[model samples]
Target: MSKPISMSRRKWAAAWAVLCAAGLALTAALDASSARDQQPEKSVSAECDKYIADIETQLAKAKQEGTEDGVVALAGVHAGPENDDCSDAFRDRFGGDE
Candidate 1:
């Protein structure tokens, strides 16, 4: 006659399969989240570009004719480590209000 299988062994095998499936699911979720987080911040940069452009155009016009409007534009121009003033001015002149 054949011997019967042990209950403890069967339970352990089931538990192990469940744990592995859970681990795989967790890994996939984390990878998806990381990918989402890596997307470039394009909108914020685009808005800032518009502001910078306005300032630059004003500066250029001021250079050409020394007008008060140019001076005001210069005041509104964003100047710092993160923006290009000249490009910003060009964008502003082309209608980048935000």
Candidate 2:
């Protein structure tokens, strides 16, 4: 029983819907970019075995201390030695945290 919408009004409504969708998409993209920028990337150049070994050591220590969060809350290392330097330089470049 209601009156039908005019062509202009329908077009306006469609345009409004499109604008809203675009706004939402833009907002989502900005949010994603912000999140990516906020988090520091973990880039360890050390061998995979060594990297995992360090994590395992942290896990073991956390387990002993009854604090699982310890390992889970570890900050990712941004810079690390690419190759294993087992000589005297090893201690200087690589930390002995593990």
Candidate 3:
């Protein structure tokens, strides 16, 4: 008669399979989480580009007016709103403010 396989070998094989499945699940979860984090960065970058483009368009319009007052007004607009780094950078770049 043939002998049955040992219980220890059967248990070991089952445990190995379970461990591999758990590892694969963890890896997939981490990859999905990472993908989610990157989406916001991409959207913010697109929004920043839009803001810059709008500013440039306004500057061009102001330039076409061809008056000192118009230029000064455009400079004020370019300085942007108060209490923001974007405005600060705009002022610094165009020599509007500190």
Candidate 4:
């Protein structure tokens, strides 16, 4: 007859299986996150487009009103990190005129 597994060996086997499953799960999650990070900058959301449009409208109004201060303030906002994608979208839409 085949020898039965001892208690210690059974415990070791269960622990090894658990570790392997955990490792696989962690690897899959990391891969998915990296895949999202690799997406192109041009894949901005609708919200980003709307934000850029709002900035454009405000800038046009500032220019029309001859408010240099308003234009400078808006420029700072447009240069912020959160607006990077929106600004890229705006530039692409406007044929890089800005």
Clashes (backbone N, CA, C under 3 Å), per candidate, total: 4, 0, 0, 0
Predicted candidate 1 versus true structure: per-residue lDDT over 1-98, tens digit per residue? 99997679879999999999999999999999999989463333665666556666666777788563533524454567565644444554555542
In the predicted model 1, the residue pairs found to clash are 52-88, 53-88, 53-89, 57-89
How big is the RMSD of model 2? 10.9
Clashes of 4: 0
- State, as a TM-score between 0 and 1, how close model 4 is to the true structure: 0.35
Model 1 earns a TM-score of 0.35
Computed on alpha carbons, the lDDT of every model, listed in order, comes to 0.65, 0.62, 0.60, 0.73
Name the candidate, 1 or 2, with the larger lDDT value. Answer: 1
Off by over 4 Å in 4: 1-7, 41-98
lDDT of 3 by residue, 2-97 (tens): 998767887999999999999999999999999887833212234444565776676677677763244333333333343255554445456653
Model 2 reaches what TM-score against the true structure? 0.34
Lowest lDDT 10-residue stretch of candidate 2: 84-93
Superposed on all Cα atoms, the candidates' RMSDs to the truth, in angstroms, are: 12.9, 10.9, 12.1, 12.2
| TM-score list, all predictions | 0.35, 0.34, 0.35, 0.35
Please provide, for model 4 over 17-43, each residue's C-alpha lDDT reduced to its tens digit, 9 standing for 90 to 100: 999999999999999999998957568
For model 2, state the Cα shift of residue 97 in Å. 32
